[model samples]
Target: MRSGQTGDEAAVDVSGGSRRGREMPLEVQHIRDALRREFTSRISMADYEGRAGTDFDNAFLSRALAARAARILTDCSSDEAAAGVIDGRDDFGIDAVAFSASGSELWLIQAKWSDRGQAGFNTAAAHKLIHGLKKLDNRDFDQFNVRLQSLADRVRGVLGLPTCKVFLIVAVVGEGRLSEETEAILKEAAIDFGGWGRTVEHRVLNQAAFHRAVREDLAPEPITIVATMSEGWHSRETPYQAFDGLVCVEELANWYADHGERLYDRNVRRSLGLTGVNQTLVESLTDDPQGFWYRHNGITVQCNTIEQEFFAQRGPSKPVRLTLHNASVVNGAQTVTSAYRAYERTPDALGEAFVTVRIISVNGTPEGFAKEITKATNTQNHMERRDFIAIDETQSLIREDFRLTLDKEYVFKRGEIDPAPASGCSVREAATALACAYPDPILAVRVNGSTEALWEEGPGGAYTRLFGKQPNACQIWRTVLLMRAVRDALHDVRSTLSGRSASIAESGALLIAHIVFQLVGTDGIEEIDSEWESGLNEVPALVEGVLAQLIPLMDHFFGEGSYVTSTFANEQRCQQLVTGVLQALAEGTNVRDLTTFQSDIPKPRRRPSTVSLIIDHNLIPAGTRLEYQPSPTEEQAIGIWLRNGQGRSFATWVDDRRRPLLWEADGQRYSPSGLVTQIWRKADWREAWSAVQGPKQWYVPGEGSLVEIAERLWQRIITEEWSRERETTKDADS
Candidate 1:
């Protein structure tokens, strides 16, 4: 057994190797070097695999490295000498432990290793480590900070002890690629954990550090990538395909743009007869001609910009009349006539000057084509610039509405940050309202004496508690949500009255009210009266904003729906609703105020289309009435015609029944027998809602009984329809 080895370490190692022996010093140094190499190698490979995989494995590598270090410490020191043992509980900061001479100092080492790229060590990784140490939810800044400060206090509580010393050793196994802000945080942590004015050393062992360890034979395994071929391999030709998990420059270029300029030029040149015209010079001119260049088949030829430029620069040199009568290319070369004029030669003097040249065209030159493709693709990154788009008026209002809704309903949740700023116009108003709204804390007293109440525990005690259902958390949460909605609507109304645009103001207020209704029960309005009064000054402004902008825009967006239906009663009902809403707005009261007056009863009732038919008539035959029944879909038309004249069947009744219908004396019954005879007479009403109630006959004009009943029934059906639709939508979402 090793001299410094613990009992467990000794049991693990069969061969005895004592640290107190002469070779102990050399052996310890060798092992440290080996560890350094392993760390460096992990970093390099991890980086190349890319961020996602690299990030995942980096965490895994950190744990593995810590385990390795613990094993090494066990080999170097006895159980008594090892100051800190790894606790399998929720210990996040301390990974491995080391001891000093006094046995007082506790060295806590945390390792961070990544085989991914350097850029992989981002803010998320930093936040993750910190969150773990603080026992807080990740990505939540407020929670993380609160927990972190609490942990710091706990650590500070124990610092006064003489035997206590916490040394945080952050072992980074690669280039430290943490953002500047994150790096500063780690540095600050080190300073605090090690104690002020204490010696705290930091080391960065990179590639060189690993190489030294490997050369000295201190590692357990050698770093190498050994390539081995399969048992039986045969190939004809493997077509071009991308390398797995890798995107080469050529592949990216081809993906973006299929055309390759270099290859195109080569093909064009070979088509024109210029085979033996100095291959290098021809290739150079084809790529980037100095001024102008020409292509010639056996008899036909065409000159481009390069040739034009050259002739222009050199004055009027000879008009080189080169012609190709015929041309063909075999194998690698082409045969055809080609001609060129000297810089000083005149066109007439150089008549008939022509020569035949052979040119070879290469098809499969991947290396050259790939290089060109890379150069072209790389240009895109530099050429492109980002531009910020401004929000349009409609979109801007939408964004504002969305923001209002989110703020009104988004809860910080239990055991998390609260959504309040200490100072502001809204804060003061909200604070006062909240204080009165919840005068006493809502408590969940249990039968047991335990004060701690877990969300999982319900109101029921241990006996039937096993089977008793728990109430929804959303129910308890809705009260507070309603308060938020009321406050937000008030704020928007106030903003609008203070000169904000009409649409903007109304949308903002409406959004707050909508969110509140969605989050909480919308049945009671009296309870929310105090909240409405507080936000009253802003209501009219929001209404005006809507009337001025939103209504006009809606009319334009949905052109056909702007026209009102011809029915007088329908128009009158709509006018009443609109007038009621606008009256509150005119008085500087928003939707919140109206809710108080109206009891917040949601409009638009839901109902089934089919209703059972009930027939009862004094003088009319029941069979005739049953035969004269109208379809459910024709209810609206029947209702409209009934409003105009008593006992007269609507046009739909004539079309559907193919005959006229007669009404009984009570006016509720329809009889088919009297249609052909015209003997059916209109019946007097029983006057159920008359001023004089001794079986008085009804008068149609200026009567409240019949009109009121019709209006009430219409409202009831509409409300039923709306509620049904709302419930259906809610179910689907859940």
Candidate 2:
């Protein structure tokens, strides 16, 4: 239900005036009527009048629209929706605020109710929204109205969640379109707020969508399903009834096609469209339909009642017909959706597929019984795609081979702890290494995008190609060693780099590993030799050389402004970059001549302090765990002291920039640099360095150091400012 388009229209005049000659459009009139009927009693008339002065009608309409948006998007009751409305003076362009039931998603709505149905979201509105978003992100609640202030704690809580998402809902009672210029303005806001991950997105609800929401609200329909279950039997409990049996895949597909998302209205979330796991399900159905019953977890349906059709003198083994009333698929939504997709793609293949089904009837049960069933079904830990691979014969053989041949632990199970670095390697590490070592670069790219692809089975899948024939123990161990070496080298190089270069170093680690594997010549890689192990010594230099060549080649081919993360993940781009890098190496391109690639060049000295930059950009989110990565000298000096205490080397990052690191060692907060000094003093190390660079010594595990992250942010800001200046100059010239 999300789209983007362009329209150019002047902003609506909302000043107090009589509509003597204006005729409201029917769509707007219908929406106005619906809102008046639903929210007249719920809204505060006095507050609206006080805020709007003489423009009460427009204010009321705006509030009503906000309420409707809240109800539609958050699935809240009318009372809650009305309470969410904060549309008035000092509202900061955000009309309403609502959070999902789970409190993991926040929706901030900006509504424009145009009687003439010509509302337009222009650059001015987009800027105002961005300003409000920035204020909220900074936790400046006092600038907002009383209603917004009242929910400050909740808002702050949602914002602090790492996985939380903020959706800016622009609800305009006109055509659902935005000017390209306005769209770019909003996109800039998204980029500013998103940082390394997409935390913000915007959605527009126009005239047609507004009407649809109103109609759907007035008369909501309950979905009913008719399914035949083989060997079905019912357990007649005191308050509820339960039925367990097998259902055909075709029936599930039909149910989904008929009811669509309505079948999962009561579920926590709708089907996650075509995720890797779901894609595998479709593959299973189309490729091996006969084995679907054995491979799949099937579906669960909860209903108000179930009516069974009587069969005269039929045996217990006969199929039973049942009509479910007000049915909702509480679990296995992905399975149902994937089955439908498979059926759509290859209908003939699904005839042999049967799925296990469990039906629960809430008739005469407790009020929250259905919800309890849903919560229980979804809360339990289910098997992931990787879990299936644990039982693979090849993996089992690899495990045995590691234990006997290499004398190392090769853990493959989901809950088993991964072996420490250099001690051994897990299946995940092995797969990534093997993918990087493979002749084809696509495997490396696919694994980089998602490791789920590594476990994908069947023809032309990574799993089939990598482990089709049980790989030798020596090959797996050796490749894993080389990959680990590449990662270590990249980690060191990333510490001194910033911006896109740092990102390329981190995200492109696998591609770099693949290129290094090629350069090292994998002739003796299959055999454990002194020469192969000695070649590991050459990896750091190889990594530097590869990066010097790779960075410029990537820039020359895929413009300097190209997103490093996307380019590294792209198969074609990775292939081309690899080819270009190999060509450059073959031609002996002197990277030292390139000033940007020279290792001896000193970085700019006049940069903002890491703490100030991190605070300004919110680079490291609150409550992020940071680990103390002691330098070799620090390790030698205070390693024993850190190990003496259980949590001495760990700290939690708070929002306070000046004193962000809350040290676990002493339950005290200190600045990053201060913390490092404190650790040195506490360890009583006589050889402690006088000047400590704390940001470089602390890390976010998989991510880089705080200084590296701050540098990236600084570089990003400079790049954006430079781009804006260039655009401005170009426009002036035109």
Candidate 3:
């Protein structure tokens, strides 16, 4: 074998010349230079420092290649990439491992670096990787080096999740076809682990891909779009050029496939990712393609230059071809992504769909014109399903009734600030509260799944059932208060719980609230100063009592190992759980101890620092975006501040626990609580509370809050400990 070359690396020669005689490709050289510059200090020196000259360089390059793969594929920062590297003597053919921020995928990277850009992934390498995968499957972390062992807990945790996929990334510095034997090895491994779901997959990152990633890292290439728009019209103004037309859904999907999120770099935000609004966009494209253009607000593109290649006569049927240079979608990013997803699902269905397009070229305009256009387009308040409810006559009547009868504000407008806790409630709160209070528990389930269902107007919809009859102001207010009380009580109860129970507390709050409402009885709820006030007062104690019975009942009906989120979201399961709990309550049956549901010993009176716990356990992957959900009081005070284009409601989570949240608004890092306090101060809200539990206020969108994530991790640790203890006991018995 050549010096510094492994057996597998020596076997394949994609390039013609010998390793020492061949000259390095300029792209490969560039990649090498960039990697050394970025990762020399970042990669652990202890791993490769023992070697000299070519050997040292080659080993370091191999580790650097793995880090690069992590950064490029996982979209993680350099720090995370370096931390992910586990390349060493006992690496088990895996150089690095990284998790997607969403926790949906775990990437296992194997890298090969060659000076002449002739790195190869041969049958030997494939077999080694497959053998490593089998060891991982058997939970044999001890076989790997200390670096891999350090991540064993996190790896086990991720692998245990049914939803998380394992991706084997084969990264080589050369471009060549994998041998049939090598391909077979990977395919057989994937099949062995795949079972019912595609649990394992592989991707090859060749030299060309590496080059693209390197170039993108240095400076992103500007996105250029070639669009053929029908019914196109141009603005006659001099300072800037603008075009208005209709673009086919197919074209938008193609752009998304090619450019992805690069198309939204200049936008205020990236695609919101399957939000309720975006889901509706997807539904429209798939279900009613022809009507999508009429129902949807079209996309706006900002470009450096626009050239009309072909223009037909001034008829609606004629198509005009335009080439847009350095283009970015400033608005309707959600629409574009949604279209892409919808197209992916049902490509044939979207042929009839078209979206209106507005393209603007600020090439000759003022310095800030492009920015101004981006700002203006995004600043305008867009309509949601709830916004349409604000226009309803019944909602107006409720607003008037609150003013005339209760002397309180009942804000129904989408952008309007929610009233203070003591004063009144918004339509959203009222809807959710009323949903829980409704006779059928499925409405509450729908609300828990997505609040959008509350505005869905139809015979069977929650909106019609709750608001179709124009519920009285007193009923709305009382139920809203009751729901608030249930939530507050549940939040306290949730803090004491861990594992699936904690998840149940978070996801099944509405269900629990609905159950509490049922037990309290809904008679005289509409009457002022009625017995319902006493029931509302009993809520805190009632919530605890109900949950004590309800949680145990859920485990009995649904298996103890069942996913709490899916259980609560499923209408049938929730209905069954509610029935079982209510029946037990009515019969005065003895309930299981709440301790049976507890996954860990009681937490200390002084809560551990969230940042420390998160970093210690590696519960959240780096570069995850956490969303800010203001406390009820803070929401009332800073609604305008949050909405004022300040980017106040989002923060990127870094690995640093002391200052985990990198605030997007000011480009500064702060502790979760510290950031909340800062926002309060910046908003000039004098009434801000002295104490803030920041983890409770920030969430990872689809995932739970920081507190919840930490609790789950703790629960997993305790469960694993118990399982080990049980195994030991079984062995002793044997």
Top-TM-score candidate index: 3
Candidate 3 weakest lDDT stretch, 10 residues: 598-607
What lDDT is reached at residue 64 by model 3? 89
Give the distance in Å from residue 71's predicted Cα in candidate 3 to where it truly belongs: 5.6
- Return the top candidate by lDDT: 3
Task: Give the C-alpha miss distance for residue 425 in model 1, angstroms.
Answer: 66
Order candidates by TM-score, high to low.
Answer: 3, 2, 1
lDDT of 1: 0.29
lDDT of 3 by residue, 458-518 (tens): 8997899999899999999988888889989988787677645665666578889999999
Our tally of clashes for model 3 stands at 0
Query: Candidate 1 or 3, higher TM-score?
Result: 3
The per-residue C-alpha lDDT of model 2 at residue 530 equals: 42
lDDT of 1 at 97: 51
TM-score for each prediction? 0.18, 0.57, 0.63
In model 3, residue pairs whose N, Cα or C atoms come closer than 3 Å (at least 3 residues apart or on different chains), thus clashing, are none
Residue pairs in clash, model 2: 499-712
